[model samples]
Target: MKLVIVDDEPLARDRLRRMVAEFPGYEVVAEAGNGDAAIRCVREQLADVILLDLHMPGLDGLQVARTLAELDVPPAVIFVTAHSEHALSAHNSHAAGYLLKPVRRDDLAAALARASRPSRAQVAALAGLDMADTPAYVSARTREGIERVAVGDILYFWADQKYTSVYHLSGELLIEQSLLALQQQLGSAFMRVHRKALVARRHIVGLRIDSRAGPLLSLRHCRCSIPVSRRRLAEVRALLEN
Candidate 1:
């Protein structure tokens, strides 16, 4: 797997680079001194996974994660931090896993193994959604490995130049596909609610007319309100009314 190491301390990056040498089939694609450099390296080098440090000068790990979340093909994040309190935040941010400072080779291997394994339920879930007639799985390449994800579990898909970002019930994953291709593969179960957004019909709970901003739709588990494009307002309303 193509991997990048991001840490403020040079020793930390060196240590991880040395330890990663023990793992077969894994190579250090790049190394960064801070979140900013890490983001640049991952984007330019197409890193599959990133071993990211939580604390740093300027942009921190969480900030890096948030920025990565916006990317079309985001690397699977494995946070390497000393603080346990940030564990909850890491999970909330949909990170693959975490490793403490002075990471053990065993722990790193285990995390990679978990990331590499296919979730059996993913296939079953796609079957249940009855989207087999269409291409419903997306290929997500992360720092640990590549994974196949069921599109049915995806809450929404957003276009990013040359790639698509998928937000699902369990977590977020990114794949290199145009929004047009994703919309085509997803078929009728998904609707293009806006020029850049496609939402799952199942995740749309209700539509609310925002007096100031016009119309909005509530997503099942997401707290933020999703805007209803003027052109799609009628369709969104009809979908909800039905």
Candidate 2:
């Protein structure tokens, strides 16, 4: 696979290039110092993957990834950053991998091996296009790697401190996104049942009044009921009635 290395520091770029050379079946097609240059290089080389730096002077990695997503066939992005805080943003950008600075050879190889060209639907989703009135998928970082859950399969999202928990048909995972951000991206299909939770409108079968918890939402496939705030109780009832 063709790869593009984008980093402002020449030494950092060199280190990545050397590590990439150790691996077979992959070649460094181009190198860029900044986000704009990286975009130009990717377009010219038609790179299959990009080892993108998170912090840059101009567009920044997130902006560049969003721009690349607008292309007809966008390459997979693997964010290489010193900071771990941007993992959530990288996930939102549809990154193929997330690597920390001072990258290890094994991690780099693993990331490259997993990297593949993203589909048009994925590209649209990365570009933040509401083509289907909601994002195609929601991503979470796991011990293995990045895990993506289809929006249709999601039951609800519960906010737990810094991370938001995703409950889906298959199982539950954690994503680094605010509940408000998820609600906006998910659109009308998800309702903010409480300050800490967002429930899928389609999965909401009924609302039961709990003696202890007050009002709780019953989901189609979910075993546990989601707590509904008193403020949003009227709205939830209206939605169920309709």
Candidate 3:
């Protein structure tokens, strides 16, 4: 596997490079000091994975990841940051892994082992073939590492402050992407029932009138009800009837 290490600090990059050298079958194809250089190196070297630092001078790691996502064959990103706070943002950016500063060998090994390769859909999209409008899975960072929840299994998405909660068949997870972005990416499979919530059309059981909440959307396999705004109440009802 070819790897690109991106860190503003030369020492940090050297440490990562040395650690990576210890691992067999993986080579450091390139190294960069900033996000722009990182992007350039990845493209030039055709790197398979990137060890990225979050807090750089310009075009932070998150911005770089977003830009890379637009590429026909984007490389897997593994954020190597000191801040734990950006974990949700990293996962939302579809990062393959998140490692704190002073990265451990075991953690780096595990992350590389599970690093995402270009999906078949991505390959098809590059070939100008028909593909799904949205990604097949939404990822979340956990104690066990990155867990991917199938988009089809998602029941709803609720925006809570800075994070958007993804309610799927198994449970719930928080991602940093906004509702508007998700709505745009997910397309017709999800409906904007409220300003703060998006419900899966396939999981909609019905819309029920709530005495206090006015209107609430009931979803299959979900215990809690999602409040529907009065402005969108008619739309939700129409969705249910259809």
After TM-score superposition, the amount by which residue 221's alpha carbon in candidate 3 deviates from its true location, in angstroms, is 40
Residue 10, model 3: Cα distance from true site in angstroms: 0.9
lDDT winner, 2 or 3: 2
Measured against the true structure, the TM-scores of the candidates, in listed sequence, are 0.51, 0.50, 0.52
Global lDDT of each candidate: 0.78, 0.87, 0.84
TM-score of 3: 0.52
Off by over 4 Å in 1: 117-242
Ten-residue stretch with the least lDDT total in model 2: 117-126
- lDDT (10s digit) by residue, model 3, range 39-66: 9999999887999999999999999999
Model 2, residue 198: distance off in Å is 45
lDDT of 1 by residue, 1-242 (tens): 68899998999999999988998767899999988999999999977688999988999999998997676556778899988888888888877779987798899988765554323233334234443456647788899899877655677887777767888767788788777777777677678888778887767888888889778778875677777799999898887787
lDDT of 2 by residue, 120-154 (tens): 36444444455666677899999999999877678
In model 2, which runs have C-alpha deviations exceeding 4 angstroms?
A: 117-242
- lDDT (C-alpha) at residue 38 in model 2: 98
Provide the clash count, candidate 3.
Answer: 0
